[model samples]
Structure formats: structure tokens, C-alpha cells
Target: MVPQLRKLTLMRKIKVDIFRKICTNWPNLTCLHVDFRQEMNYSLMKHIFEKCPRIEKLKLWTTMLIDQRCMELLSSLEHLSTLEVLLDKPHLTPVRLRLLTDACPRLKEIHIDWNYFAPQDFEYFLKANKHTLTSATLLWTVGEAQKTSVVPLLKQCSTSLRKLRLVYFDTPRAMETVAFEALGELHSLHELSMQYLSTYEPKLISRAFRPGCLTQLRRLLMQYTTDLLDETVIAISQGCPNLRELRICASYKITDVALSEIHCLRHLEILELSRCSGLSGTAMAYISQLPTLHTLILQFTEDLAKLQPSLRLIVELKELRCLDILKSGNIKAVPFGEFPNRLLKLRELRVTYESENDFTELQRKMPNLKISNTAWLTEDDFPKDDDADYGYRDG
Candidate 1:
């Protein structure tokens, strides 16, 4: 019998039972993820930690309330290398965050989903754990008035951080100077994802790409507003020499000039230009010329005819593996047979059309192709609208 086959609703209950069984029968359990709605009672959490002494990776999703016993148990787990916590509350008070950090001195990576927290509490956590923290993800919901404090905390931790993702909510003005100033100090940073709230300004975004601050950065994701200009794009290409993946979807202002600037990224491999209404044939040709480009995504563009002329050159990109041309209402025609057979390396293809006949014709031309109707796909099938929003554009 499997111990009466209990139905566990909470992650904690499942973890407790599984680990208890593992300790009794197996010698080691290395990884655990707990998704529990309510806070874990400290003693029960400690018991699980004591059982899984060899655990190296731990992921916890819990309510806002701090369980001191759980914290104490976590502190005793000396081998923890990766810790990811998703908190239901808006913020983790500084003291509780510090306690967790202090317990895991050997932690190499930490990801936190902070719902509500004081700006200084984050600063204190950074200051206390600066030496041990190498990568951090902070999802913050901050007000307009509290924006100034966010950057200083980031700047303080930038020296030791290699990857930083700052997601802001309801605080656009904070995206300006303070954030960039802190970001510029991150000498070792390789990846950055910054999503600004409604208060984002063009100047602040431009400043983030200023040369020398992001010398080591290879990947950058910016989610801003339509106010971003061509200068910002130029500045980014010039600043990050090793950039390999560039996703600028939903940027209504991107034009031929901005597209041309992307050529500066010699190492670029993947480029996504979805929902960019200003793209033209010239822009498409320029992108097709990227020597290292393997994957190209152009979804929901307003001008499909502009891209039609460049399709031949695009198919000639020998290294191209995946192409997504979905939701371009302007693409009235597709030269399915015209594509060079030499593009044998192509693997994945996505297109959107209302007519089943059009899809059938496309499938007949490329028998190995995988086609998806964007009209039928749900939001989960594609990146979220807000995640795809590239607000910066050259007006």
C-alpha cells in the first residue's frame, strides 16, 4: 500500500510527506519545489529541512507571513546552491529577507517575486548580501513617490550581480535616472531585463544604453513606451557589443533607420520584430543580411507587402532555422514555391490567415512545415501583450 494514497492540496503537505518517505526509504533528495497557499508552520518546515539535508535547490511559493521556524530550518540547510521564492504578499519586510539571506551564505542565485516592500528594505538586503549574491530578479510594485529609492539599492548591488531583472509596476518615473545610474555600475552584468511602469521616459531609457556601463552585457530586454526614439536604438547597438538576442516587438516607432542600426550587433542570432507597424521592405532586407541570424520572428506587422520583396533574400539566409510571420494582414500573397530549396535547414514556421485554403496551400508547398493560425491561438500560445510591448521607438 502507498500509505493510504493521501490527496494533498498544499505543496507543503506534499513536500512533507514525500520527504518523510524519502528519508525513511531513500538516502538523498536533492531538489524540491513547494507551492503552498498558506504560510508553512515553522516546526513542520524544519522537519522537512532536517530530512532533506542534501538538498541543493529549493523553490518556495508561500503567503506573505514569515515562518521563523521554516527560516531557521532553511538556514541549517548548508548545501543550498539555488533558491527561488515567489511571495504572495506585495513585499518581504527587510528583516525577514535578511534572515533568509544570512542562512544561505553559499547561495549563488536568488529570484524573488516581491509584491509589496519598502524601497529601503530592498536596499538593506542588497547591502547585507552583496558579497554572496551573483544573480537576482526583483519584481516590484512601487508607487510614483517611492521610485527614487529603487535605483540606489540596485546600484549598491550592481558590483557583484551578473544578471538583474527589475520589473516595475505603477512607477514609470522611477525608470529614469536613478535606475540607469545604478545599472551603469554593474561592471559584471551579462543579462538585463527592465520593464518600466507608466512613468517611463525616453531620456531615461537612452541613458541605460550609454556606452561603458553595460560593457559585458550580452542580452538586454527593454519594455518601455512608444516614446523611445532611434537614438536609443543606436545607443544600445553601440553599447552592448556581444548582444545575441534582440526582441523589439510592439514598438510602433521603429523604422528603416533603426533596423539598419541593428547590423552593428555582429553576434546577433535571434531577432523578434512583432507588432512593429513602421517596418518596410528595406528594413526586412537589412535584417536578412545579419550573418549570424538563425531565428527571425515578425508577428502582427501592419505592412506585409513591404516584407514580400525581401522574402527571397531572407530565404537565402543559410543559417536561418525558424521563421514566424504571423498576423500580417498586409501579406495578401505568399510565394510558397518560390522559396529556395537550399533552405533545407529550416525547421519551424508559423503563419496566420483566416482561410483554411491558404494554410492548406502553404502546407502543400512546404510539406515539412509546422503552421499555426494566430487567429486561433490563445494568449498562452504567444508571449503576453505586455511582455511583447516594446515602447521605445523613433518617432
Candidate 2:
């Protein structure tokens, strides 16, 4: 009866008969996200393709091995534009990718765990969808032998690709200067996220971007790289003048010098620095210079003394709306009473405090502000900006 239903998400598994019946009733559905545990067979996939003619986005989290028949059936969804397949078995290959991209030519966005496919497979997929693909999430674990020239493949779709996410489990050696040179060629890229694990050389990833290369970039996130330098941040600030959101996590090498350089980004709105121990609170004066800043997150600093002075600088962010200072148990409770009415726009504040009165007093002072004493806050805990595209968030 719900024929007008346009979107649906099912986190839990459903019976095959029930799924088919639901699909039959919601023929106009354009988006579907379902956990197809054991019910993902050719017949079920066929029913979906036949029933949901308007389906544009499809996410299948399954335990079954995806076969050629399933791929072929998915190809029949001519309206499909975004595809996400999280499977227990590694069944996505270059040949399968060709089937989907060739048949469903409208498909432009893909979200997949790159661990399921080889480096060559990824290359082939990018080359195949180079013209139409706009967004891609490449999440993989790097093996020593798997180091390949991925940036060049990404550049093939530079004119069309807008958002890209690269997450590596075991980061390899610092990329040669040539690799980042190729990455800078993505002229149309709007958002980029690079995350690494067990990274030692602090300057490895920073060398990836040269000033004035990624001019179109608006949002950039680097996590656990420990590989950013003051020069790199300065280059980013000078090059990407329009950048609005910037987040760097676990970067121990970035000092107050780099933080001072960020004042060049006049359009910057959100800045998050997590576990960047090299920063002294003195650089906070530079942050207060940003006229457009609304959200600030300085998390996981071990030294409270270094942060106490920085807290005073935050009052200068007249446009500030949200602030999070949650650290891993090391941060002692800091009273919010110090933040006066100077932060007129401030509405939400998150911190780790032991006393209940600290929360009560802050609420009493700023009746409109919402304060949380959460011990931990993840990316999901913070609400995303309303204007965010491609699931990019300030958090």
C-alpha cells in the first residue's frame, strides 16, 4: 500500500518472502539499504530489479558470496546511481565491476571495502567508471606488496570525481613526491579523507599536497597520519583558500607554527585538532583570528595547563556554535563559567567533567546552550552540518 515510499533502510535481516512482498508494494522506492544475510539469491535480486524500477541508491550488506547472476541482475537496475556492497566473502572483481558500471551507466557513487578487491581490480574499476563516477570510498589494509600508483588512477576521473576517502590499515612507506604530485592533479576534487594506522614518519603524508594544487578542495581530513608538518599545513592554507572544514587527528608533529598559518584560511568554518601534542596554547590566538569559525574541537591533549589559556581564546569566536574538549580520561574537569557572554552564537558544548555543578552552572549562565558531560564523543555523536554533501561532516 506504501507505493509512494522513496527510501527504506533495514538494519536487521528479513525473510525472503517478506522482502519480496515489501518490494512489490513499494515499487517507486528510489533508495534501499538492507541486511541481506542469507536471503541474497538470484531470485531475490531479480525481484528487486523488477519491482523497484526507480531505485537509484542500493546498499546490500550480505554474508552470501555474490555471484555473476547477482551482478547481472543488479545491472538491470538502470536507474541505480549509488551502490554499496559490504559482503562477508570477497567476490567483487574487475569483471564484476565492468558488468555493473557498463550496464548501469548511471551509477556514479560507490562505497566498498577495498580489501575485498586487489589493487589492479581497483584500477580497472576506476578506469571503467572514469567518466561518470563522482564519489568513491576506498577502505583497505595495505600489504607491502600491494603498494601501487593509486593516485594516478584517481586522476583519471579528476574532471568528474568530487569526493574521495582513502583509509589504510597498515600504512606503507612515505609516498614518493611523485605520488602526491599526481594527487594534486585532481582539480575537481571537493572533499578528501586520508587515514593511516601505525604511521611513524611524521612528515610522510604532508608531502602529498603542494600549495595551490588542490584549489577546489573544501574539506580535508587526515587521521592517525602522525605525518603532518607545519609546512604542509601552511601550504594547504595558502593553496586551498576556500577550504571550510579541516580535521587532523593524532598528528604529533604539527606545532603552533602550523596552527598560526591556518589564519590564512579566511573562509574556514570548522577546525578540529586531535592529539596534536606539539601544539602550545599560544597558537590559539591565531585561531581566534578566523572570522568564520563556528565549530572547534581540541580533543585528547594530555596537558590541561596548555589548554587552560587556549580556553580563554575561544571566547573570541563570536560565530562559534559548537565546542568539544573530550579527552581520554587525562583531561581534568574544567569549569565552563570562564566562557562569558562573549560567545553569543555558542549553542552546544561538549566536555568531560566530573562535577554535576559544572554542567548546571554553565546551563545557568547560558540558558540556550546545551552542554554534555560525555566521556567520549565519536564522529557519529556530533550532528552533521545541514549543507554537508556526500556525508561529509564537521565532526
The CA lDDT of each predicted structure is 0.63, 0.70
Tens-digit lDDT track for model 2 on 163-212? 87755433345554445677788888888876543344544445456676
Q: Model 1, 143-256: lDDT tens per residue? A: 224544455566666457887766543444634566666666676888876644333565666677778878788767653345556777788788877888777766667677
Cα TM-score of candidate 1: 0.78
Structure candidate 1, residue pairs in collision: 90-115, 90-116, 91-116, 172-199, 225-391, 228-393
Report the error of model 1 at residue 185, Å.
Answer: 3.2
lDDT computed for candidate 1:
0.63
Question: Each prediction's TM-score against the native?
Answer: 0.78, 0.85
**Regions more than 4 Å wrong, model 1:** 1-27, 36-39, 87-95, 115-131, 139-148, 169-175, 223-227, 306-312, 330-334, 353-395
RMSD of each: 5.5, 4.9
Query: How many residue pairs of model 1 clash at the backbone?
Result: 6
Best by TM-score: 2
